[model samples]
Target: MTALHSSAVTDGDGDGDGDDNGRRRELRVATLVAACCLALVAVAFVPAPVGAGDNIASFWFNPEDTEAAAGDTLELELVASTHGDLVGDGVDELAATLEYNSEIFTVTAIEHERMLADGDSAVEIHEHEEIDEDSGAVTIEQEREPSGDGARTTGPMATVTFEVASDAPSGNETIEITDAEAILISDYPQGTFDRDAHVQIDGSAAAGASDADGVPGFTGIAALGVLAALALAAVVKRRD
Candidate 1:
């Protein structure tokens, strides 16, 4: 009877151990599942870097080469582009000025173009002018404020018509954007304009639409972010 009792005790201990091990395994599995869920949530909600692009922006007059007879009227475009991505989201305001030779040309008119960004709905604009004759500087300031909804990344900024002076010099001259003493007003704490953006640009004989080259590997990353969200959703559905 003692031997039988001992056998029974041994069996009971073995059974208890088996049960405990089973519970541990179940707990480990639960922990793993929970970790995976948290990963998915993070993937779905985490915001990607605001601009996965070069963040490079250029504002310049189009048709870099433009020419006309003295005293003739000349029309030109001022365009702004974000090389790879749309403008940053935090930006709510923008202001830029074009500085040129007041002795060579006189400002005739300034007009707003389509939205600067591709999908932007509304951008309020303010056009201001200052002509310094003694210094031979003509400043045309264009201010843009995005609506609460947001602004697009790139597009035509304005149309500037100039009346050339009858006695203007007969040679190519610059229609420059202010960057040194005066600056390009852009938000994100108002970044200064790049000389590189306009480095290749020059006022030409018949100004044709042109663009400054954008640095590669700096394209907008909106697509990557969207993919991350979609991957998270797929993982969640697979869990079921």
Candidate 2:
């Protein structure tokens, strides 16, 4: 009877050890799965490259119009409708023509190239130079040519970016795109330049205007906030 009891105790010990091992394996798997899920979620939050049908030709300034004292700098953005192939070569080639109160200012172009694989967008600034009024006809040209390597067979698309100093002649200023040009891919949809033109003034420029804090324009920020909340919730659930 003593030997039988000893054997029963040994069997129970073995069963408990097996159960512990099973539980440990399950926990490890769950942890690994959770890690992979987190990695995927991180990738999802990354901005995707602009693809076909993405509007790259048109550009606009946020708040469209604003009022500022002379010498005040307004941060403007050149937003592409799509993250199209044209970004590979560069975005600096695009030009901006600012006309205020008949005084024209041409800003030197700056380009920020983004790699599609990395999901990064580039920014180009046209700030260094300002063109004064031109009595002769001023030709605003966009000399965008694809690399002959055929890598850009789909053609490239991008927008011009620049800032406008409130140096207007202290009066109601009217800004308009005197002209624009772009390279087009025969097969792809050719984006219209007409949408790329506009002007803005301070406090009372247009019906729809927002401050630089991006208050009224919260689309991008709102999306990111929602995604962050979801991720936080996932982490809490996993910990529990």
Candidate 3:
């Protein structure tokens, strides 16, 4: 009778041990799945660092031109396709133009305030250079600092903005802007304008179209898509 009772107790202990091991295995698998899901979520939501190929070949001094007027504040907003702190390094050149009387009017300005998209900090370039031209093409070169803080920092993306006078030429003139000889240090592709990117004159507010054979405008949709894909991956991983 004692021997039989002892066998029964041993069997109960073995069963409990097996149950505990099974529970532990399940817990570990669950933890791994949760971690993978979280990683995917982070990747989906996090915006990638902008690169040189993503740079805008051209943008309007006044996109909508809602308030373009002679003697008025001609607000020139540069809509660069690429936006990041690292853009500063890849920028090889910069140019701006205002068309008038069948001729193009180009201006030169200094790039200032290397601010981030989040507007948290400003970067300083080691070298600031500009092209010397009144019309046609202009080039700029600068040495940009790398990203991150302290030692072992990564490269920074080139970022720049220009401020031009609103006193544009009149009488059938078109204000054209182009980024001349803009080089990218990254492995991605680079581009330039052929005839130049133009904004119509005659005090009319309209969006400028790309030149016949020029690089198309950069949109934020690609980045958004990447994020979405990452999110989907995370979801699938968790489900698995």
Candidate 4:
């Protein structure tokens, strides 16, 4: 009877130990799950970085949105911004192409701005401007002659003069930067962004409104559809 009792006591102790081990394993699993959840939540609250680099250079028209009358002449300033920090390099060269409705407007002239010169006339700037009337495209290229450290400022790269057609109808027209690129003083390619400009012509009668299909130019509704589709495609592509 004594030996039997001793065996039963040992079995009881073994069962107790097994139960304690199971409870410890459960606690460890719970702790690990909680830690993972907290880490995910913290990441969700963090803001996304704008760009990989310290500086995010961008190009856009001075007056992003403006109005012009038929037969009017206006100047559009193509501005570049280099959000340069202590560690970021500056812009030394730039190239861009502007697209517009050929029938509605014409490119008269284009001149370089002082931004590339760093506001110093002693700094020479080489500029080239070409107008393609057939396609309504204006190509602009500018470089600092002696691109040392580059200009770390924001200002106009070129001032484009446009002549509105005599009989342009009242509507919204988009001036888009189809292509653009920039180079830093380090000779490495710099990240850049471009924005489109909008010009609203105020006139009751249509001046040069006709597409190749022999129909009227893009109405506000048509333009909105195209713009929305383009924006959506861009977003989707970037996401991919």
Best by lDDT: 4
Give the local distance difference test score of model 3. Answer: 0.41
| Candidate 3 C-alpha lDDT tens digits along 191-218 | 5433323334433222122122344433
Cα lDDT listed for each candidate: 0.56, 0.42, 0.41, 0.81
Candidate 2 Cα errors over 4 Å, as ranges: 1-56, 82-96, 102-132, 135-171, 185-240
Residue-level lDDT of model 2, residues 1-240, one tens digit each, is: 455334233235565666667778999999999999999998999888755334445544443565543434444343333233444422323334544443323343433322111222232222232445443122233422331211122222222333444443333443454444333333344243533333443332322232334565588789999999999999999999
Q: Please rank every candidate by TM-score, starting with the best.
A: 4, 1, 3, 2
Candidates ranked by lDDT: 4, 1, 2, 3
**Cand. 4 TM to true fold:** 0.65
Task: For residues 1-240, write the lDDT of model 4, one tens digit per residue.
Answer: 455443232335566666667778999999999999999998999876644355567899989999999889978999988855345556678889999999888999888787877745587888888899999999999898787667888889899999998877778999999678777776666677899999999853544333233545546669999999999999999999
Which candidate has the highest TM-score of all? 4
Q: Which lDDT tens digits does candidate 1 get at residues 172-240?
A: 667776641211233343333533122112244333222323554344566678889999999999998
Q: Evaluate model 1: give its lDDT.
A: 0.56
Off by more than 4 A, model 4: 1-11, 14-54, 119-121, 204-240
RMSD of each: 23.0, 21.3, 21.0, 14.3
